[model samples]
Target: MAKKPTKDPNYKVIAENRRARFDYAIEDDVECGIVLQGSEVKSLRQGGSNIAESYATVDDGELWLVNGYIAPYEQAKTWGHEERRRRKLLVNRKELAKLWNATQRQGMTLVPLVMYFNHKGLVKLKIGIAKGKKTQDKRATEAKRDWQRQKARLLRDRG
Candidate 1:
């Protein structure tokens, strides 16, 4: 029998960067801090928090994540944080400088991969450095993925 996928116990996904996979070839990943308001943090824990439309930019010696959405906390009072505000991403000086340099080149981008709570129960963001893929590259990737899936299915049947 084919083994089923296992879910991690500490798993709680706040957001996913779907376009990152479709558009870019991720080269390196980094875990960074997310500065969120109290209400935003509360809402994220309740689920449906996603950064699908988000992308990263470095400016003024800092990294920013724009277009991320954290829903309003239902129980929170007024004066809540903005749902689609640009949030700061924490990274060391060397990484920040490197990202800025990489972004200066054409077709390279910084994209969010996932947002989840760590073992310490703090929210974290997984960022990736990637280069954009062309239309033909996308098609090739899809074909390879389909072939792999079919191959796995045949192997399982034989076993």
Candidate 2:
């Protein structure tokens, strides 16, 4: 018998923004619920969504996700969602205030890190408070990563 792959309660990632780490210095992370249309939810389940170019914004005392691309469901013709529609994010007032304050600071912005299904099977977006990294900072980050990889390889070979 083989073990079947099951959705883990911890997290089942749907889409991830790989470039986020390389482009920004992440400061804080907050998991937020997303308000999705009927067709959008189905499209996300089918697994072709993209959050790589998406970001979160505070608007009129609420949070909104901008530029995330959830492809229209193929089965739904006229009712399909727009590919790049802005979706509302569900966060409490306190959390929203924190994000709003942080975003008001210089060099700080909100970026969506990943979208995942939580333990309750609800879709969530993990947004980060980040600062744009300078060219030198990016180079330093790459160097540190390279060194870590080299160290791990050397340790494995010696064992």
Candidate 3:
């Protein structure tokens, strides 16, 4: 038996968008901080948020996360935040310029890949610059993934 690779202890993942890979060809990944309301942060701490259908867009030179769902905290009844509100993303000027240029000039998109808390306990979003995949491309990706799984199983059994 072999020990699995040690996971990083500094980051605690809150949610992931597994479907993003199936729908788009990811090009580059960028980590950016999120501007969250106190109630929203509390809700995320309790965990059941979804970023699967969410996307990031640059508006007026600012990046905003759209369509992401962070469930309302039951305890904060009066201060609960909107479940699907557009949250602002914090990126530096250079990265922002790069992302904006890629999306506008190259027809790329910003998709949130993972939301996690860093060692400092600050919430962050890992977004990817992606291009949409066609149906044929998706099918081929699925076929390749299936083959990899089968190959792994065969190797394990033989060993």
Off by over 4 Å in 2: 1-10
- TM-score-best of 1 and 2: 2
TM-score, prediction 2? 0.92
Candidate 3, lDDT over the whole model: 0.94
| Candidate 2 per-residue C-alpha lDDT over 48-105 given as tens digits, one digit per residue, 9 for 90 to 100 | 7999999999989989999999888999898888899889999999999999999886
Model 3 Cα lDDT, one tens digit per residue, 27-89: 999999999999988888888699998999999999999999999899989877889999999
Model 3 worst lDDT window (10 residues): 5-14
Error of 1 at 48 (Å): 3.0
Give each model's whole-structure lDDT: 0.87, 0.92, 0.94
Off by over 4 Å in 1: 1-11
RMSD of each: 3.9, 3.9, 2.9
In candidate 3, stretches whose alpha carbon ends up further than 4 angstroms from where it belongs are 1-10
Better of 2 and 3 by TM-score: 3
Per lDDT, the best of the predicted structures is 3
